[model samples]
Target: METEPSAALMSAIVTEHFVLQSGAGTTVSEALGRSSLYLSALSSSLIALGFAAQTPGLLLPFAAAALPTVFVLGVFTMVRLVGTGVQNMLYLSGISRIRGYYRTLDPEAARYFARWGAGDGETDDALGSLAVRGGPMAGLFTAASMIAVINGVLAGVGLALLTYYVVTDHHLPAALAVGLVAMTAGLAMFFRYQHRCYLRVQR
Candidate 1:
């Protein structure tokens, strides 16, 4: 017989899904910010390089670019390290909290909660077991971070070339600027849409 889930079952499923999605959203937002910063730094360095290369100095141009590049990469690495670390801990802690919550309810109700809670627990367990037997969250966050990194690299290179041309009194390149603007707008729209989807699911 086809049976409807109990109220407790519904609650458990919703809670688990909410937690996972919230975590994912946070991860995506963070990656977006980091990617934007990385790209901006790279763009600045390229602009500085173009300007410094015009001077009669020996080390200025290279130093200008190298210093910023080093700073960007360093920041990127540190952010990834910290963010992934927190995500890992949060995943485990959230699951633990969920399991504990289910422990106190009536047995029949608790059974439904237990089933969904098990799903929640398994989500964390699978991630935790990925590497170091506790690094799935870390790895997932790292992978997500790379998506932004890759986008930043492309955006940075494009903006740098555009800036170089602009400062040199060359006709401002319309195409690159247009492309960057389009990409930024698209990312914003995508995030907004995803957030709306999250809300609809929650409601």
Candidate 2:
């Protein structure tokens, strides 16, 4: 014969479910806040760069200083966003587990919750459905990927400016080629980091 859970046990589980939901919400807010902050700073930097460009012979120097700083900030923001994303996933899993428990207590309630109370695999699929069925490319729509792309462009443009002025004596073609390569490399690195983070989470 199966014994029923005590009132205290049931209350604790409900409280835990609420807490996990709150935590997931917090992670999402934090991700948005961080991304907004990075973008605002980038915008301010661009404005400053524009003002600098208006001055005689100030554009390159100003860009050389500002672009790297923005790129670094973007890198940090991207990493933190990835961390929050993982945390959010863990919180959602916890909430799903609680819903699963509820279904166990009253099997008919499972229908109300849809695939959420089905099983872990089904829950994962349901959660991931928002990202669509595409593979890695689908993941690029995330905040972290947005930051990665911006940072890559910053790095490439900054390097191209330096190369054109210092190495190639204002050779536009060579500089563009170098910039493209740098941008591609930076994006690859950012994507690799994202992959590693998710891989660790899965483990």
Candidate 3:
């Protein structure tokens, strides 16, 4: 006859997995949030400086450099956010896999997460009965919220400034073309990454 694992051993394993998964999820969530906030603040500050730089005379000389600096910072910040989001997806991937194990151990765990959510409803009602299942990410996270919209605005401003700077400094229309191409490529890659992440959860 085949022998099954003892209840005590299974309990210990489940408890340990729960603790580890919880801690990992919290750490990733906090890091991702903080990173996003920092990037947003930095982008806003740069945009502010860009405006200040437009002032005639006085600090204009120093401020003239701010555009390039701000543009570069925004680019780097976007890259970092994209990378951190991938990290978030990885964390989610691992945590969800563990959740699968737990659900198998105790089928009751499955009900804790909602599979579908109502699009229009009172906040309380949605959260209580029909809110999206996953936190922050919400499985794919493809839908744009207010924050995502703001981030896109910031990125748009940065790209516009950067392309303008390239044209002005280099006097080359080709450089502007390149920047546009790069932005499009980056966006395509981002969507691909998100799509793959969403697919992982499906399985």
Number of the predicted model whose lDDT against the real structure is largest: 2
Question: What C-alpha lDDT does candidate 2 achieve relative to the native structure?
Answer: 0.80
| TM-score of every candidate | 0.39, 0.90, 0.49
Alpha carbon lDDT at 200, candidate 1: 35
Clashing pairs in 2: none
Q: Write the per-residue lDDT of candidate 3 for residues 1-203, one digit (tens) a residue.
A: 54566899778867766775675466556545755665576666667776676775523444356544644554554454544444544544444444445555455766873322342222222222323453435523422122333444445545555556644664446555655565566555555655465455444
Q: Write the per-residue lDDT of candidate 1 for residues 122-195, one digit (tens) a residue.
A: 44443443332332233334433444445444444455444555444444555456547745764454334333
Ranking by lDDT: 2, 1, 3
Tens digit of per-residue lDDT, candidate 2, span 52-150: 989989988888888888888998999999898778767876776777677777658777755532235533633553443324564577789998888
Specify the poorest-scoring 10-residue window by lDDT in model 1: 131-140
TM-score ranking, high to low: 2, 3, 1
lDDT of 2 at 118: 28
The regions of model 3 sitting more than 4 angstroms off are 1-4, 31-33, 36-40, 43-47, 50-54, 57-64, 67-186, 193-203
